[model samples]
Target: MIVLASQSASRKAMLDAAGIAYEAQSSDVDEGAIKRELIGVPGGDVATILAEAKALPVSVGVPGKLVLGGDSLVEVGGRQFDKPVSREQAAEHLRFFSGQRMNLHSAAVLVRDGITVWRHCETARLDVRQLSDSFIDSYLNREWPAVSGCVGVFRIEALGVQLFERIEGSHFTVLGMPLLAVLAALRAQGELEA
Candidate 1:
């Protein structure tokens, strides 16, 4: 059976929508600590490292089960934005993203029997329309609770799509799991019927 080492509702929803059978378990790894340790690495590489870190611990305990772990971040210019720590922070993040194009990096690792069987990073570019202060405030109030690791202030599945002018990437990657790449990896490993 496939085990998903994350508590992300979006990831679970993606897996379910694809009709993939899997078990969900929260890895509960200290993500802040991992990010801090990887501070010296490039932002994209940091995302990959964080995903592997999350998957490895779960894989070690599950014996032969295949475990999937994922991490996503928003990178603009050179800075990486982690989850917002407060409403104010969320608002600030939205302001930074206003009228700008940014990159979203969603990285995943699939581990089987304590070894990484496949890995991928799905990068998508999003153009945020010019947003007013009031819009930012309202969006933060409405979306902050639902959005945790999301770099942008809005949840694309919800009202968040309205905030974007254009999104150039796979829909699944923008959603956070990159389902196409995951499917390809699974098929190659003979874990899924193609």
Candidate 2:
């Protein structure tokens, strides 16, 4: 089993559905500080940095085990977005995103003994359809709080699908991890069957 350095439900579900066994450990990384430090970095690079930050500490603690750290971020019109702190902010974000193309960057890193052994990042493009205020309100009414923990204010596997008119990328990437690449890396490292 590997160590999963996040408490995110979507990550857990992805691993679970893939039959991957992992011990979930919250990385406790200060994300805001990392974002502040990475100001102006591309979204994918920022995600990779965040993923490494999360996994490295856990890898130190686990000593011999592989630690999987994953992170995702949203970029719209050259601005990076974090998880919305409140419903109002989420609504505002949706308004700005209306009919805009959103770049969702998901990244994952594998580390052992505090050394990163593998890393990957994937970007997904989601076209946000024109959203009327009533539609936004209705969507938020059903998805708030739950989606509050999600970047881009979405959980693609859920009602968040309604926000997009078109999506171009791996489904797993949109779900917030480069899961196929991660699984391949695990197999390459003999953590999973070849």
Best by TM-score: 2
| Clash pairs, model 2 backbone | none
- Tens digit of lDDT per residue, candidate 2, span 2-39? 99999989999999999999999998889999899999
Model 2 stretches with alpha carbons more than 4 Å out: none
- TM-scores of the models, in the order given: 0.94, 0.99
lDDT of 1 at 21: 89
- Name the weakest run of 10 consecutive residues (lDDT summed) in model 1: 146-155
Q: How many residue pairs clash in each candidate?
A: 0, 0
Top lDDT prediction, candidate number: 2
